[model samples]
Target chain A: MSTILECKNLSKAYGGKTALSHVSLSLNGGHIIGLLGPNGSGKTTLIKLINGLLTPSEGSLLVGGHPVGVESKRITSYLPDQSYLNANLKIKEIISYFDDFYNDFDKARAYDMLEKLSIHPEAKLKTMSKGTKEKVQLILVMSRRAKLYILDEPIAGVDPAARDYILNTILSNYEEDATILISTHLISDIENILDEVIFIKDGQIVLNSSVDKIREENGKSVDSLFREVFKC
Target chain B: MAWNLNSDRPIFMQLIEIIQISIISGKYAPGSKLPSVRDLASEAAVNPNTMQKALAELERSGLVFSQRTSGRFITEDVAMIEDLKSTLAKEKMKQFLESMRQLGFQKEETLALMSKFLKGDHS
Candidate 1:
């Protein structure tokens, strides 16, 4: 598999406070990678950098062999930690909005997920619960056929059932060769879906290896290992 | 079918064992088509690469075979399944005896106890 995203000595600074230090890693295609860290550890910053929302302060950040720009944006589908869509729009309208915005958005896939989740596209986003809105947002994001999907805290706030639905939608969708980089502190929930995990702390990568390697060598799950590594 | 996995062990190893049990126990009947790697991965809630590796291992062991144009299928050989079942039982009994030995019981006494349990003893 080819490399989809590569970061070399990538750093981010706002004013004098550095949110991310010199972090370096290269991710290959056809993988579900966990970008795991506690809160305020620059997971969101790294995701934003990959999504082209912020420029790296020092080093190279590439998506599909090119720097973060129009090309990278075209290939990367991003879901931020907070809600980004308008609450005033109906679900159907939001679907159309995404359809107009991203060329890779698959309308059929989105509708299929909506139907399965029993979400009415005609219903107003404001009328739904927070979990339902999150599900809607997730469905829209996963329906894209992008090369790289950078999801920030995708399963944090949702209930267990919705989390399963979101994970299933994610697994069932996406191209086989595309890569998914999901950032979250909820390690146990998403650990099963991940092929590899990159454990970051204070903006530095602490561990990067295959899940099987970690389990076989340490005889523990990623969640337990995470607790041991990041114990406060 | 649902896949039950413990976070303590390697996923590929558990996946191979569970899938083998399914095949041998007729949950996935002989000569039947198996799910695609992606669907199976999603069903098992594990990585697709891991599922692919397990299937490849099964294929190597003659429990599974693939048709290039279509997909993988369980072996139609009932003898092979029976052979695997016996092998698994032997492994289980060996482990059982080892645990009994750890509890300070000899093999003969353990067999006698097992026989008594199987004999419908109330006490």
Candidate 2:
């Protein structure tokens, strides 16, 4: 497998405070990895750096062997923690916008997912419930056939049923060459789907290993281990 | 059968057990084509790589086999399936006896209780 993401001594700072320090990581393609940490543990900082929203204050980062730039942006799809969609636009209009923006966007696949949820293309985003809006946003983000999918807390704030839908959508979508990096503290909910996990704490990587290896070697689940490692 | 995996053990091992039980129980009939790895992974809500590892173990154990063009299939060896079924049953029986022993029941008493329960003697 190819190295889809690589970070060398990556660090980020906000004025006087350090968010991430010397965080070196390498992610391979064709796996679902969990970027797990508590709130303010630099999960978002790492994601932003990879998405080119923020430049790393120190060290170098690369996606698909190239530095984070237009080339990387073309192949990376990011779903931030907050809602970035316009509430005034209808679902169909959003689909059109995504299609116009992303060359790899599959409009038909997006519509199919919407129809499965009974979400009408004419329905305005503001008229839908939060859960439905999240679903729509997820569908739009996943519609792109990008190489790397960086999802920041995709399952947080959603109900169990909707969480299952989101996970299933992630599983069914994406090609064999793509990699998905899901950032969340909800480990147990998504542990079953992850091949590997990176535990971040206070902006530093505390653990990075395959989920099965962790369970086999420690005889404990990743969720339990996370609690033990980051316990207050 | 559903994939009821726990977080305590390696998921691939649990998958092996589940598939083995399914095979011995005739849920996946002998010589039947197993679903694609992708389908199995999605249904089980697991990483395809993990599912692939489990399937590879099953294949190595002679319970399952794959054809380059057709896909994976259960072994047609009825005798081998029967042997596996009895092995699994014996393992379960051993665990039941062990638990009964822990509950302070002697082997003979446990056997008697088991027979009585088998006869529908609820009282």
Candidate 3:
């Protein structure tokens, strides 16, 4: 498989405090990787760097072997930690917006997902619940034929049923060769679906290994191992 | 149909056992085509790559075979299926015997208890 994302000696700092320090990692195509860390652990910083939202203070960051730029952004679909849609627009209008913005966006797939969720096309964004909005954003992002997908806390603060729906949607969508990078503190819910996990602690890459290897070697689930590693 | 996998073991291994049992129990009859990897992965709520790995392992063991155009199919060899069933049954029997021995039950007493239970004696 080709390398989809790589960072060499990547570091980020805000004034006197450091968010990520000398972190280096590479991701391959056709994987569902978990970027797991506690809050304030540089998970968001790494994600932002990949999405080209913030420039690195030192070292290099590359997406699809290209430095973070228009080319990289064009092939990378990102679901931000916060909802960023216009509240006044209807669901259909937002779909059109994405259709116009991204050449790879699939309008039919987006609408099909919306209909599956029982979300009417005429429903306005402001009226939908928070969980519903997250689903919409995820559906839009996954509908793209991007090579790399960066999902920032996709299941946070949602009910368990809604989380299952979101996870199923993620699994059913996406091409086989594309890669997905999901950052979350809730490890157990998504552990089964993860191919590998990169545990980030205080902005440093602590552990990177396949989920199956972790379970086989450590004789414990990723959730248990994470609890033992990041215990306070 | 539930893939009730435990967290302590590797998932692909569990998937292999699950599919093996499905075959032996006639849930998935011999010579039947298996579902696509994507469908199986979604049904089990696991990564498709992991499912593929499990299917590959099964193919290696001759429990399943794949054709170029058609997907995957369970083997039609009944003797091989019977061999797998006996192996699993022996493993379970060994475990049961070990547990009974741990409880300090002798061979004669264990046989007596099993005979009584098989005779539908509740007391």
Candidate 4:
């Protein structure tokens, strides 16, 4: 398998606070990888660095063996933890923006998802509920045929029904050769879809392994292992 | 019913079992087209790659066959289905016998107890 994302001695700090420390990991294409960590454990920091929104303070982070820049950004479709779509823009306009920005964007697919969810193209984001807005944003992100997908806390703050919808959409839509890195602390909710998991705690990687090996050797579910490992 | 996974085992193995159950139980009828890998994955709420791996295993076992462009279909051979059904039954019966033996019941006594229960004659 081709290596999609690689990090070596990657560290990030904000003033005196260390968000990530000596994180070295490599991810290959064609798998759903879980970036598992608790709140403020540098999940967002790592994702941002990969997307070129933040620079690593200490070491190298490579996407397709290229440093974070335009090429990497072009291939990476990112869904940030917060909404980045303009509130005043109608759903169609956001679709148009993505279509213009990404050569791989499939407008029809995005519209198809919106239609399935009963979202009108003319509806403005400002008028929608938080969950609705999030769904729209997700549709936009998943519509792109990018090489890597970085979804930050996709299921957080959503009801169970909505979470199911989100997971289903992701499972059904992503490109075959693409690698999806979903960062969330909700291990149980997203555990089934993950091929491998990377457990981060206090700005460092603790465990990184395939999901099956963890289960076969440990005789425990990922959720159970996560709870035990991160017990307070 | 939608597939459910136990976290302590490899998903590929569990998926193979679930898909086999579906095939033998007639949830996917013989010769009928199977859902695309992505559709099945979404239905089972699993990754498509894992689902594909399981389906490939099923194909290798002759329980399913794939045409390059037309997608996969359940095996059309009735004998194959019957074979799988008996194999599954044998597995269940063996497990039951092992448990009964662990409880110190001889084969004859276990058979008697099972027949009594099957007859619904408990009073």
Tens digits of lDDT, candidate 3, A174-216: 8899999999988988988999999999989999999999999
True-contact fraction in model 4 equals 0.91
Comparing candidate 1 with candidate 2, which one achieves the higher lDDT? 2
The RMSD (Cα, Å) of candidate 2 is: 1.2
**Shift in Å, residue B96, candidate 2:** 1.1
lDDT of 3 at A107: 99
How high is each candidate's TM-score? 0.97, 0.97, 0.98, 0.93
Shares of reference contacts reproduced by the candidates, in order, are 0.77, 0.79, 0.86, 0.91
Lowest lDDT block of 10, candidate 1 chain A: A165-174
Q: How accurate locally, in lDDT, is each candidate?
A: 0.91, 0.93, 0.94, 0.91
The true-versus-predicted C-alpha distance at residue B98 of model 1, in Å, is: 2.2
Error of 3 at A85 (Å): 0.8
Error of 4 at A97 (Å): 2.3
Query: What tens-digit string does per-residue lDDT give for candidate 1 at A138-173?
Result: 899998999999888888888987888788788888
TM-score of chain B of each: 0.94, 0.95, 0.96, 0.94
lDDT of 3 at B117: 97
Q: Give the distance in Å from residue A51's predicted Cα in candidate 4 to where it truly belongs.
A: 1.2
First chain of model 2: TM-score?
0.99
- Candidate 2 Cα misplacement greater than 4 A, ranges: none
Ranking of predictions according to lDDT: 3, 2, 4, 1
Best by lDDT: 3
- Tell me each candidate's i-RMS in Å: 0.8, 0.7, 0.4, 1.2
